[model samples]
Target: MIEVEVEAGAWTAALPDAEAVAARAAKAALGTVEGDVVVLLSDDAAVRALNARFRDKDRPTNVLSFPAPENAFPHLGDIVLAHGVCAEEAQVQGKTLADHLSHLVVHGVLHLLGRDHEDDAEAEEMEAEERDILAGLGVADPYAAEREGRA
Candidate 1:
């Protein structure tokens, strides 16, 4: 079971189906995993606050994942998206806002399921899973930009 609580103020008008997009992405990422996820659709300022409080960062990012401690709850964790950053990235990356948001949800859920990119091997594996999951939803691979110029 997955539950995504979206908190979007003025951005709500732009993403009419934010919940659906998040659900689709989360469900795909949880193929073999289990747990509910919380999603927050906020602006850069809100995200920046979260980043500073949690990760010790001081800037807004596209997405931030907070995984529940091992077996702590029925919930996987929370996935917060900075709408401003997401929109900017989507435009720069040539992707639709919805598609980009979906990708970020998938990426966040993967982290909750213990997927990380702290190392090369882990990154490749996680990226592969991301591509596979996103492909099922007709979303282009989010890592396409990173792979450019590679064989």
Candidate 2:
């Protein structure tokens, strides 16, 4: 079973159906991996700080994932999301905020499962997995939107 702990830090509005989204994303990404994951929803400033600290990037990102060590038992690490960025991306992509958020959650979960898209080939694989998972959740292909200049 997959477990999720949600932390709403510096977010203005409450996330609607956050638990369900997290659960779905976890299941889609890890399949039957028994573990606990933490999801944090925060404002742009917090996410930006985290990005700067962890990734050495100064800009705020939509989502960031930090995976636990291999020795850790039933713990998949954490996913941090910037609510403001997500909303803005959704607006720019012409998709609902919830859909964008769902996509990001799934993407982060995939990262926790040791998935990376740093290279073209790896990106293709990761995007394929994201497409399949998002499709199961009734979300359109996020990469397609990007390719069409809609995201």
Candidate 3:
């Protein structure tokens, strides 16, 4: 089973449906893992701070995932999402807010499962998995739209 503990209030409006989508993403991303994970949805300000502090990017990103520390009980890791960045990306990509958010949720979950896209090949593999999982959830292929000039 997968459990998600939300740490912020920015996603309260999308929480109900986001939880369902997040569960599906977790199931698809982790396969058979059994544990709990945390998802922190916050405004651009919080995310930007986290990004700058941890990743040294000095800017807010759509999502950031921090894996669980060694030997942690039932805690996989934490996923931090920036609401404003997500909304803007959704708008620019011509996808609904929920869909974009779902993609980011899945992306973050994949990271917790040890997935990485540090190179082109890895990114392609990860993107393919994301497309398959998101498609099963009735979300369009995020990369396909961009590749096809539909975004």
Candidate 4:
């Protein structure tokens, strides 16, 4: 089960089926693991606050994932998204807001499952997983366009 909490925002108007995105993204990566996830659709300020408090970045990021304890089955983790950041990124990346949102959710879920992109090798592996999972969700490979620029 996926729970969506719109923490003081009008996300329903922008994303009516927010929870669906969370559920699909998480399930696509979850595989055999069974657990519930909560998606917080919040504004930039909320995300920034969390980022500053937890990561000391002092800025809002696209998504933040918080994993629960090891023994928490049927309860996986929490994914938080910044609306302003995601929309701006979608516009910049040439993707629909929905598609971008789906990708972020998938990315966040993967992080909860121990995926990271802190280095080149790790990023390549994680991006491969993201590409495979997003493909299954009918989303285009996000990095394809970036590679297009180089080629």
Best by lDDT: 1
Residues 1-151 of candidate 3 have per-residue lDDT tens digits of 6665555555657555666666666676666677677776678888899999998999999999999976995788888888788878888989887888788988998898888999989998999989988888888898976677844
Residue 141 CA displacement from its true place in model 1, Å: 1.4
- Per-candidate local distance difference test: 0.87, 0.81, 0.80, 0.85
Runs in model 4 lying further than 4 Å from the true structure:
none
* lDDT score at residue 121, model 2, on the 0-100 scale: 97
Q: What TM value does model 4 have?
A: 0.91
Q: Residue 104 error for model 4, in Å?
A: 0.5
lDDT of 2 by residue, 1-151 (tens): 5565555532435456766776677677776677888877777888899999988999999999999997886887888888788888888989887778789989999899899999989999999999998998899998885677843
Candidate 3 collision pairs: none
Ranking by lDDT: 1, 4, 2, 3
Global Cα RMSD, each model: 1.4, 2.6, 2.5, 1.6
Write model 4 residue lDDT over 9-104, tens digit each, in one string: 555667777667766777787767678888888989999999999999999999999998888976788999999898899999889877888899
- Give per-residue lDDT, candidate 3, residue 91: 88
What tens digits encode model 1's per-residue C-alpha lDDT throughout 1-151?
7776667654567778887888888898899765677877888999999999999999999999999887776787888899889999989989998899889989999998889999999999999999999999999988888799474
Candidate 3 — which residues are off by over 4 angstroms? Answer: 1-10, 13-16, 149-151
TM-score of each: 0.93, 0.87, 0.86, 0.91
Please report how far candidate 3 places residue 51 from its true position, in Å.
Answer: 0.4
Cα lDDT, model 3, residue 151: 44
Q: Which stretches in model 1 have alpha-carbon errors above 4 Å?
A: none
Model 1 alpha-carbon miss at residue 13, Å:
1.7
